[model samples]
Target: MKSYSTRAMALIASAGLLAVAACSAGSGTSSGSSPGADQSLSIGLVAEPASLDFTTTDGAAIPQALLGNVYNGLVKQDDSGKIGPDLAKSWTVSPDRKTYTFELVDNAKFTNGAAFTAADAVFSINRVKTAWTTSLKAAMDVVAEAKAVSPTQLQVTLTKPSNGWLFRMTTRVGAMFSQTGVDKLATEPVGTGPYKLGTWKRGDSIVLQRNDAYWGSKPFFNQVTLKYFKDPTALNNALLTGTINVVGTVQAPEALSQFTNNDKYQVIEGTTNGEVVLSFNNSRPVFKDVAVRQAIRQAIDHKALLDTCFAGRGKLIGSMVPPTDPWYEDLTSVAPFDLAKAKAALASAGVAGTALRLRLPTLPYATSCGQVVKSQLEQAGLKVTIDQLEFPAAWLTSVFKNADYDMSIIGHVEPRDLGAVFNAKYYTRYDDPTLQALLASADAGDEAAQTEDMKKAARRLSEQAAADWLFLLPNLMVADKNVTGLPANAITESFDLSRLARS
Candidate 1:
């Protein structure tokens, strides 16, 4: 079983990326204390140019926080986790399940003022089949071809059955970019979303105002500001001074301390199932054996991840399916820490005490997971070497796209649907045919059939160790008390911020 656990790296990192980008968010915010809630809103976030453009990592380069503001997909998911209509009003799947038809809404318009239609949807998917999609294969693999049947009707052809194809369409890659925007967007992007584009200062700041002519919900605030910060402390300072409105997954043990006496502030912390785990590119030589993978899993103390890195505010995970999601199989959550068993597994794989050097990107998720994991592996009898780079990218270049790492650490989110993580990684060298088959079966069935299929896939993934599913925890979203209408979506946070009833 090749462990595909999406430890916090992939999960919170995107939220973290928003925070990284928050440092300079206040750089030139009209230079004053925000006057009134009705006109302007400054939200804090951190983002690295995960991709300068789409060619970087998958077809979608921007983090959810940024993309949530600037891009509109066929459907929109709110921060509350509701999947609602966006560019497309409704869609129907063919009985054979190879085809998916969608009806586009009439009023949708791109930032450039071009009409959005079924043709653009087809263009987004089909264009990815070409050179524009190199980094996006894993995310785009299940999609075969996309085409339009009419000006407002679009169809998608898949290589196999896919129940969650529509959801994937709303992801970053799923956002529709103007045909004209595609050429100029490498530097200046144009999209159909709630907020219009503002000046994008690479290392410093980003500012946007509500698209008053928005097609959907009207944003409560007029101006939306995003800044980038390299230091977590500096970003927190913005929050302290009230220069920023919110911070996602920022590490501060005393975060409560900062907000204690402030009536205008609020803190939201809960248990989320997002976990961070290591993945061995099964296509690579050293990680070819299940025993070696098991040994690595056994070596780390997930509880320590919670204590040291999370400041005692997280859950330890032992499976690939997060508990917060319904499709998650209960059994994967049962692994107990057994150092002896882990060592035995390593010996079984003939990897005990062997030189196992790998590249790990240290960012977001639990702080110090890479460093802590390295120390644990050494104690478990593996010769460890560390090549630290930025999060997500290091793993992307080394494992998924280029296959350069010995072992990689990543945080994976078990999206609302379980099949997402599995389909992206299964048999892409992880080699568990059962897991792939279940996901394929899901695509072929109805909603109920799909859920059951995903549950079954969850079981297979737990058993196959496609990766450690890890723990289910709550997402932390801190905002000004004035920001109203925060929806209680399950842990699966949607990006639809327009519906938020801010004061």
Candidate 2:
């Protein structure tokens, strides 16, 4: 659920105390009235959600649009990537770290008029184990039991001590659902957050209306519109022409100069956990050979790819571990770009000139980056074919679900998504017991041990060329000067409309 198309546009925060980088020019005021005068605002984004039901859907788009704005979890991750209380007013963990007791807020109510209670928490957690179909549901497998000790108190016991279980709760897997509103999740979503579904025009936009009866402080905007655009030009045009007040994700990084030269817009540049990966299907006969994988990794010039595809606006991380993760390491040197070494590796594997498919989602970054990957691989004597699949629908079904791809390009935007994407059963089909063991050890170890072990796991993964990490996508946004509370770092899947306010 943390993975999305590169254009999905959600960024993440770092662990501990992470500083957010943001800058703007001109007066921070839109072409509207003063503070609290404009009660509605329109924002532009790419890659709209396939559906509203995240329990059955897999991509990050749903959670990016709905998580913090519509649904409230037991715990929420702040912009700093620190976990804090949300619906659960407070919580206590046992000394053993296997049990968690939560005291729920007494005043929270769902959009459907159902009062939120500990029983709803029980139902939601159990539903993840029983009915959720997404791969992200595996995060809840560690839970031994979820019980409502009282109407406003909930308890959950994990099967073992896990350093990541509580953190994962800050994701979509921890979203609380109402029993009464379960029937129409795909069409209508009801939650205890500050906003409710207003109107959704499929392929165009979704409007979220403020919940007058929300338990938390009311958000500044009475209504927020999330307008979708497949074409990056249209996305920018919407902001330039006043169709939207904000370009939530500047899809065309090269076009930023148009806004940067103008005094009406503020450009925010920050960091995100979104790693644009060149993933290989390990189950495929060609990729099953580690030598071939290594050759592929060594063939591409990451610096050149980043420059051509993203206007050199991102970082070359060389591994799945983004800088925000505590276990991060700069492993780009592990597989230096060497055409001669690449050819030698392919020849040793008896796969030189082997034909391979490079399927790509229609997301802006993938389509752009795939060309460079193909041209580079071909230079190393591999025959590469490019196939563009419609994003979220065709790409999610063919590549992400069925593993019907030799290789693909995607942006894994979820914070700390190493364990999920590399799972044996995941679409990558990367079944390595040693890697799995290291990840397990990292999760069960103490904070210091976890960091050390995770570093080893990441190094092992990169050394083996498990996947080619293209680069870390930068968080870039262009909004009207008046839009305040814009997060400098995208630390979670949610765009968090509640955080936005007019200056």
Candidate 3:
């Protein structure tokens, strides 16, 4: 079999190529050495996530990547954030750019010997679009519908052409699930990927064995194990002690520095091209006007925030679309970083003296962005409030369903599809002719036309101040020196853990 590394190289040559894309690994103990233990790979995660289901939460980036051990997508993004073939051996887009017809690879099957077919992809997309309880693809509302036309063919129709529709389908939210497996064995998952779930010990660790049946290239070493840690310190300690072979989620810069200084570990940085943004309820009377948006932008110094909270490891961003992306725009015409301009803009809009109260969602991201913005607003002479949130009660109701904040920070990770993140940040109109024309030209219609529309959209996103684009962040992955092929942007899920091996 071709090594996973070679496969990744070929896949990258095929996708995620244009990306140039870092955060620090939180502190941890190194287990094993550079190159990792021989028999099994042990990994760590930052949170005890709510679900292992792909459609639920994107599974917190770390575990979901390993969970490829048990789940697979028909198509997935390569490191460059470009779509690459997965279960689908090949595909064709309609000339109109609205229909995507996929042809499944023959002889593909899950661990349980169940055949992998195009029907699974259709079922997965439908589940995502129709399921009300899922949090995975809230940003992806572009799919008009998806269905299976034949055993090996699936079709996805969009309301209109959306340049980002393809990328969105390759995400975790779009991971293909076994129809029978999902109906009966969701708790006991099965996937046609590189690895298979070997054992699940509740509240403990999950073990994954290499899937010899996988049709594509496979990982080098045999198995992978993921351990959960509420606090990163414990996860790091395990790495240092050699109890755990690798740690996946690195949220602390100091931790990354510590790991880098040690000769025992290798740090992998990739462009997640995701952001931690401070969003506004545009429907809210105060945030509706562009001047107030300018004031909020003026009050918060993104550079200062990055230095203070992220340990100076972050990209200062100003819009929903990442500046590095081809579709990105500087919108030099939008509000500048000038504090006086912010204040003057607010005064002209007649919202400067008004006290604006907002709540900040803290659990998702590393810091309380609300508190940070609150201080900035106060400095700008506007009274501000930062209400900290916690738990099932505080999270959904207060943030999404209720729009319960004057301002709040939201986490958008693995947004390979700009539409997946952009919609949540802006463009919520249920229907519009102008947006329709732009999106039609975007989807699969024409690259030049789509690029032009996307450029216009990016500028409009900034001019409208859709969301105060706070920080464009890169995910920092710290791997033991023993680990190889787990490089950044290697996969859509990023860093397939199946290949890591200890010395």
Candidate 4:
């Protein structure tokens, strides 16, 4: 097995080969001698997990931040985004790529002490396939059926060749659960991971204890605590005051200097899949014109927007695909910053003086980003009024589902998939068969071919100005200097406990 450092270097070489391509880890913790044994570690979480039942929640970063510790999928991802054997000791794919056969790890036992087997694998896969709104259901829906060949063997048959089967397995949605364990899911969740749920106080914190009977290497700490906080400043203060041992994914980039400039902490930083976009509702007449959309894209300065919003924490992205993705194309050239050109294009589209209504939800970065966008659009001779919603649910219901607004600024954070813009069923208001065909072609073929196809599709999207590409959100992890072994790649889920040790 390759170390994370080696695998990460390979990942960067394969993904970012452009002249401006460079990868560096975020700084939160300091470089010093390791500390003595610490029995426990506490993390300040931005929000509580949506649901303890992994099958129900959307499995976004917040949900997976907690669920990742409590669940074990058939396979697991290493710190560097490579898939490794977990409950399933090994797996072989059929030549056609439609069937996958997995060999179970015989000694693997669920937290409830039930022996994990092929039946559990069949049940878990089918559960997600039938579940209506699972985050990974779209990907798993291709599974024709999952059956147990024997107590120690399982086979999954897919309707077509799915490139995401193995990648999806590394997520919590693919986590295996025993029948008895799932029965108590609402109150107590059980899995084969290193940690078991110890206690839960709704809206407060979740406590996890080491599963001593774990089949793999155990965690160094006896217990782990996840503390929830809605405020980034509060979370940073906690880390500084020693109320929490670590802080993962702090939303406010302004607070980063508090840890980055300090010598007592270590910070691991890198780009994540959360590529922010200035989405235009294509159904609206004002934005329906491609000229207007392209004008809007060129109007806002990517550098100024990212600098004002995240204090220059992340890099400018071209399409929905972030720079961290292997298929990422530096299409920033497609939409260059030209306020005069933007103004001319808007006037040509006959919507130059219209005050477009921009509706935004109050996420950590939304308000500031929206404000900057408003200023830039106004400068480009496009009148704009900003309406900020207090809650994300309201924004989703009104702006996304109902199409109640003209435009909005938001970040789409799902990793390794661009279904948000490519899939017709998703929230994008565009209805183009040509673009859909290009996306399908991009998703098919061998690895190298897929990379070329992805670049083609990304370029097409950029040329058409699919969505106003803003910037790729960066992943930052801050911890006490004594802590170690944080993953250096873009994955937010696999923050493995076994990797951490206070020196």
lDDT, candidate 4, at 272: 66
Q: Give lDDT tens digits, candidate 4, residues 450-472.
A: 77777777787788886786787
Candidate 2, residues 1-503, lDDT tens digits: the string is: 23234111121111001112111222223344333534899988777778898888767777777888899999987645778899998999999999999999999999999999999999999999998887778889999999999999999999999998999898888999999999999989999998899999998999999988999977878899988888888888999999999887766789999999999999988877788888899998888888888889999999999999889997899898878788899999999999999999898889998998999877777788899999999999999999998877888788878889999888877778776777568878888888889989988989999999999999999998989999987878899987887777766777777767786
Which one wins on lDDT? 2
The local distance difference test score of each candidate is 0.57, 0.81, 0.56, 0.67
Predictions: Cα RMSD each: 5.8, 4.0, 7.2, 6.2
Return whichever of 1 and 2 wins on lDDT: 2
For model 4, give the 10-residue run with minimal summed lDDT. 1-10
Which candidate wins on TM-score? 2
Q: How close is candidate 4 to the true structure, as a TM-score?
A: 0.87
Residue-wise C-alpha lDDT for candidate 3, range 1-503, written one tens digit per residue: 00000011111111111111111132111344332225567777543333344443322332343334556677765544456787887889887777888888877887778888777777777777676244445535777877778888888887767666676556555566777776544356667877877776655676777788887656665777767554556767888888876666565555677788899887766544455656677667887676677667766777777777666765665665555466776653365567777777777887767876566433424344456677777777688766765422344355544556676565444443334333433322112245445554666557787777777766666666767766755545566786655545322444465445444
Give the range where candidate 2 is weakest over 10 consecutive residues by summed lDDT: 10-19
Weakest 10 consecutive residues of candidate 1 by summed lDDT: 19-28
